[model samples]
Target: MRHEELFYLLALQKVEGVGDIVAKKLISHCGTAENVFQTKAAQLKMIDGIGSMVLRNLKDKLVFEKAEAELRFIEKNNINWTYFGDEKYPERLKHCIDGPVLLFASGNINLNKKRIISIVGTRQITSHGTEFCKNLIAELAPLDPIIVSGFAYGVDIVAHQAALEHNLQTIGIVAHGLNQIYPKIHKRYVSKIEENGGFMTEFWSSSNPEKENFVKRNRIVAGISEATIVIESADKGGSLITANMANDYNRDVFAVPGRITDKFSQGCNNLIKTQKANLLTSAADVVYILNWNFETKAKPIQKQLFISLNNNEQKIYDYLQKTGKQLLDIIALECDFPIYKISSTLLDMELKGVIRPLPGKLFEAI
Candidate 1:
């Protein structure tokens, strides 16, 4: 982004009563933060949700001071950031109405064509929760997914460490600015995390680890991933809040079922009983529900003149061959075919002996 544009975006964020949702609405209507500032008061007043009070606050000069300071910090620290419109911004987060307008990041993080999931739980993680979290990462490592979690004590730290041990990229969604690590003792792991992955936050350099910031931070953790997994939580905790936010975003929610009597297990058990979350037993449950399969190598074969197929059918055939047997629904999604179309095509291919139908609506290329 250009410096002039970023300066206005930072200033827009500082405007009172302007939260992420409101800021996004304004930016969408005005084209850019700089344009929002350049537009006349009459034009701005015509926009929905732009009240007299908001208009009045937009004139405050102190916001520019704050923005200038933040811009200097960004330049001095070599901090990397992505605006809401930039391609580098989290794709899933763009669907969320309340996602941050500007996401500040650190480290060698990469999300290109990668699967992402957020793992969250209580700060006072038990032995059972720790073991489950680590084992889950180890099992999922082969898929090469980007593991995301809060860089906190207990379950969060354990998940990040497990991903690191497996050579998988891991991300820590921190509440505070990158200027300092919260729970300072975790400083030892900072260098290592930056090496493989890194930290992300919406907070600026002057922002401290305030009480409400953690609650606010949960939204990014929930919005950026395809699913949110709660390893363990008390009846009331931040992890549960993150799970709730994920559900609100319409993302998949998974909770590791545990003994009902345990304090930390109460939240997961309640989530399962209420049907708010899937009963997660192992990584296979995630793989099955998310419809992820092990990538298979294509078996080279010469073309057969007797077989006839359309472009869509050939694509489906190749996908089934590369991924082994898959459910009918998953086949349509992966092969980019419509459900109605895929069913008939698969039946035709099955009759042709190019593919075989298995039990439970699965199909495999023969």
Candidate 2:
């Protein structure tokens, strides 16, 4: 968004009664954030849900000072942001009524045309939960899904680490500003994630990671993805909150089954028993239920939009698409397919209209 517009947007956010929903409504009717302030109070009051209290708040001079401070901080820190109406904003999140009006970030986050899912659970993740998460991401790696988390302890860290291990993009939805990292110890992982993905938040530089902020930000974790998975959680936890928000948004939610006696497993068991989430076993569960059929014929869009490839073909395709051209041996090693199996798989993929073999044992996605 442009500077003057962003300044008015920041100012609008500071208005006591003007929240994301109200701000968006006002901006939609007024055409721009500046217009909201410039429009006559009599005319603004005529808009639906525009009450006298909000009109009074909009005239507060204190909001402009706050907006100016935030704008200065944004300029000095070189923070990148996306407006709700901008194409750069997350597509799935835009569907959410309570989605942030403005999102600020640090790092190289690419949400365009990518599969995104949020994995959340207790801060105290167990060994079994950790192993299941690692295996799940490894199997799903071929699909090139963007893994998202809250960037807290336990399951969140494990999911981020597993994504990095597979060279998959991972995003950390932080509760506080990008000025500092929360839980401080997790600082070590920040640079690595920002290299491939990045951290995103709606909070301004003045905000901190307080309990209330986290509760409010939970919606971002719940609404920003295609699905939300609970790896492990106690009967009562933040992950459960995220799952509930996901359900409210009508997004699919998945929970792993575990021993009933385990404290962490209780949450997952309750979620399944209550029919709040689907029973998740393996990565195939996601594929089957989400209807990710790779063998299905593609629709004609000149370039054959949304080509569905099997896991092996997807792995090979992702590898070749990322690296341009690669030797068969490299593709096999990189995708973890055996040498004998890769050649046959590549041949099958070629016939299925996904990839092509280059000269000198090289391969590339078609």
Candidate 3:
């Protein structure tokens, strides 16, 4: 969209009592939001359902100064802004009924990548939950996908961190504006994201991280992705909301099965049992279901000591090979090994020419 149109849309979004549908109607009638301001009050009456109150609200709230201020902030932060008509806008979300009129972006990856998956789960997670997130993300990384998630704690952070670990670009859909990151604790990872990936939101830069914004942001996460994965969620978890939104959008929904006794797994298990979500036992389950061609890109299996290990060692080796460079922390999590034993075993394997260690604590299979 043109800069003027974007300016209008941002203004329209902030207009009191003017919602998406109303803003859309106003745009349709006025030719442009700027035109809406130029048109006479009587001209606005020609459009159906646009009553006096809506008109008064539009006149009162359509502040160009506010929009210009937001644009200035966008410039100051070096953030990119996309209007609904921009090619860079998420194509999947463009068709949604309540899609945002303006989006704030800070990343290099295309939101419209060949494959996008939104990973969401409980903010409070168990070790099992975090492990599942790391393994699943690592498995999917080699397939060349753009990972999407809210920048919330727990699974969201795990998903983003894991994607970056594999050198894959990831996008975090924030509930608030670009001026600040929610929880503040994610600033470190969020900073990394701006470098390697991006952050996106419908709200303007000054918007606070309101509770409703998160529920609203889930739709964007759901709409933009080819699929949604719920790593671990309780009965009332917000991740379930994203899964449901994906289902509503006709995007694939996958749930990792968990023990019935665990509270966090209840949401996922319910989705699987009810057939609302496809059951996923491993990363291969997703790859096969989606038919992604990681195997075609697969490295040839070497018969050397590094490649000659049995199934378990080969599993670790495969991860190391695919990652090319990885931290011991990541390897232990991917292989689900005991942390205490992973370092000793990795060192022994390194000495035996099974793998090579690299600077900054990265490792690679020999």
Candidate 4:
């Protein structure tokens, strides 16, 4: 965005009671942030949720001074930013009511038409969690997904490192501003991360890594991605908060299951038990649940010529071939097979290269 528009936006954010939702309301009503400030008080009052306090706060000259200072900082540091309405903004986050109106970013981050997933867990990651997290990223590396995390110690840093090992893009959604790193020790990894992916935050250059800032940071991590995966967590933690935010955004959530007695597994177990998240066994679960086309360049195989199909498989195959593409439930109902039986049969057929799964739970004969 241009300097004047961004300046008005930063000032608008400083206005008391004008959060993301309210700012969006005002922006939508007035056409732009600059317009919001220029709009008449009578006109602004007509907007829903726009009270007198907000109007009075909009006139605060101090907000303009702060905005100017931040704008100067942005210009001096060569920082990158995106407005909520910008085409370059995270697409999924645009749908979120509470998504940040202005996001500051650094690095070679590219999210366009890419599969993005956020992996969040407890800071005290276990051995099992580390192995699973690394393996999951490796397995998913073929699809070239962008890995997102908080850039904290345990799972977050591990996920970022694993992504780097595979030469994949990894984004670190930070709690504080881009001006400083929270955990001073993590400074070493900053250059490497920015080389492939980068860091993103809604906080300003003047902002510090305050306690409440982390909770606000969680929403961005949850909203920006297509899904959120919990590698490991205790009974309660920030990862769970991120998972809940993802769920609220209608994004798919996955949790790595573990033994009932494991301390770190308790949170994941609870998420699965309550049906809040899918029980993630392997990367296949993510591919299947998200309906990702992992094998985009996979060559077609004439399975019927070489592979033998069982009676159930043949029946489903014939049905799919006749219908072209069909839903899993429709295939079960049409082939007179129970839902449970059909799912396994379909998986067998998929492995045999006789059928292919499409997005939205659809299947077609290959």
Candidate 5:
């Protein structure tokens, strides 16, 4: 939240060759961006991912002007910005390694809620896909989970609008930053989302939507939810990418099986056949897997786990909430704590009824 910290984050994001892994290494070793700015080449070289290219870029400092410009633009547009550690950052998105370091928001959707599901599928959807998305989302409406989707044509748009029609909070994760809405036609719904919930993105306002950005963005959609549903996708559709990312994150991935011969159904069928996804005939399948009604059966202590946390504990707790499932290694890397320290701290926190450990050495906030 400090100006200097913002400067470092912006600078790090703008660095030409510094990806998430590299940024993690640099942030871990340097302590903070302010520290990184004062770091020497020899010290920066000690971090594994930083190479001569990164060293040169950091030394030259290309991110300052760009960051400042973005700040100014955000101010002008009256958009909300949330950094990773901010209280307002989406709880389900905070823990993923590829989670956006920063977010530009313009919607009414609450990213942190008891239930959120991302609905994704091919841009070219079929009549069946449209009906499937609409009816499924309508069924989900009574449960009131936050519905997320990229506002592309076909199923994506249908999913968001369906949630809106049902008076549920829905978020559209844009491929580009807040500079402009792709397809332009959905501009009408932008204010609708903001008035009801909101949209979010990782890229700076000025950065144009690139092909690769969509891939990077999908992880956010996948990472921030209890589950991901593929309404309809061809074998190569972007929705499949989000579903796969959900699997890697250990979140539920569901597919609505369609006619075996339909091209749009091929990806969903393959996912179900290969066991990459669970076959979901209806919204009830997802609610069952997530144990949505389990809270009603939970003891008082379990309910307390979600609400009662001291400030420091809440930072770690909220991080796990936004990001979902993460191994101690990744959590340590992102939180900038040594693995042993994080493990010990998490153990203590777990014993205190603040978090839950999942299989595969991952942790989640209650």
Candidate 6:
């Protein structure tokens, strides 16, 4: 976007009572942020939700000064930004009514045609949660999905580290501005993370890591990804907030099931019990639920002949070959395997290039 337009948009954000939804409405009606200011009061009053307070606030000239200062900060620091209408903005987030009109980013972040998943959990991560989180990323490494997290301690940092270990792009959706790191100790990971993925936020350079900012930040972590996973959380926490946001966005939510007596597992258990999230056991659950196709790059058709399949995989491959395409449940029943076993087996087959997954949980021999 042009500097002139961005300046207007930033000023529009400073207008009290005008938020992402209202700004979007104004922009959509006026065609551009600059045009919004140029539009007549009578014309603006015709907009559905435009009220007296919002109209009055738009006249505040101080917003311009603030916008100018922030713009200078952006230029001086070489900060990267994306407007809501820009093609480079997160495609999934664009559909969200509350998504930020402008997103500031740093590092080599790219979301084009990428499989993005957000992993969020309690700051007090348990040993089991850490192992589960790390193993999950490692198992999903071959699919090369981008990992999204809050960049906080516990599960957030664990997910980022796991993604980095596998050399996959990992994005840190921060609660504060990009001008400073929140925990201070995490400054060490900044360079390494920027090398692969990077940090993203809607806050300005002048903003601080306030308490309320995290709830707002949760929306981005939820909205930007196709799915959100909770490795561990208490009955109430920020991770649950993120899960609810993901559910509200109509995206898939998954939680690792744990013992009933464990405090950290209560939230995940409750989510599963209430059917708010799918019961996540292994990477195969994600692969099956998201219907991810592992065979993106081209490989010779004859390559499957050279690959070896175990007894269960061979059975499914033979069945799929004979039956053409079949539902996951049907395959499980026909192959005399449980649903959990069938899901893992199908994912394994997909990774081995012997079978391909289709839409709606259907699979066929390659």
Which residue pairs in candidate 3 have backbone atoms (N, alpha carbon, C) closer than 3 angstroms, thus clashing? Answer: none
Q: Pick the candidate with the highest TM-score.
A: 6
Candidate 5: list runs displaced more than 4 Å. 294-366
Sort the candidates on lDDT, descending order: 6, 4, 2, 1, 3, 5
* Every model's TM-score: 0.82, 0.81, 0.78, 0.84, 0.77, 0.89
Model 4, stretches more than 4 Å misplaced? Answer: 296-366
Ten contiguous residues minimizing lDDT sum, candidate 2: 293-302
Give a tens-digit lDDT track for model 5, residues 1-366. Answer: 565566678777887887765676677687776677689999888877678988888766447888788767777888777766678887877677767777778856565567888999988888888888898876566567888888888888999889889887888888898878887988888877778777888878766778988888899889878899998988777898899999998889999898888899999999999999999876657755675542222233455455565655677877888999888798888877776557546754654455677777788876
Tens-place lDDT per residue, model 6, 247-344, is: 99999999999999999999999999999999999888898789787953435347447347778888888898899999999999999998867777
**Please, what are the lDDT tens digits per residue for candidate 3 over residues 1-366?**
466676777777767777766777787788787887778889888887788887787776537779888877877878888766668888988777777767778877565457888999999979988888898776666566888999899989989999988877899999988888788888888768877788888888777998898998999999888899999999887899999999888888999889899999999999999888999767766765675533223354456534456566667777887888899898999889888767656644543345666777688876
Pairs with backbone N, CA or C atoms under 3 Å apart (clashes), candidate 4: none
How displaced is residue 156 in candidate 1, in Å?
0.4
RMSD of 4: 4.8
Candidate 2 regions exceeding 4 Å error are 294-366
Considering lDDT, which of the candidate structures 2 and 3 is the better prediction for this target? Answer: 2
Of candidate 6, the 10-residue stretch with the lowest lDDT total is: 295-304
**Global lDDT of each model?**
0.87, 0.88, 0.79, 0.90, 0.78, 0.92
lDDT of 4 at 126: 88
Worst 10 residues of 1 by lDDT: 293-302
Model 1 off-target regions past 4 Å? 296-366
Q: Order the candidates by TM-score, highest first.
A: 6, 4, 1, 2, 3, 5
Error of 2 at 213 (Å): 1.1
Rate residue 40 of model 1 by lDDT.
82
Best by lDDT: 6
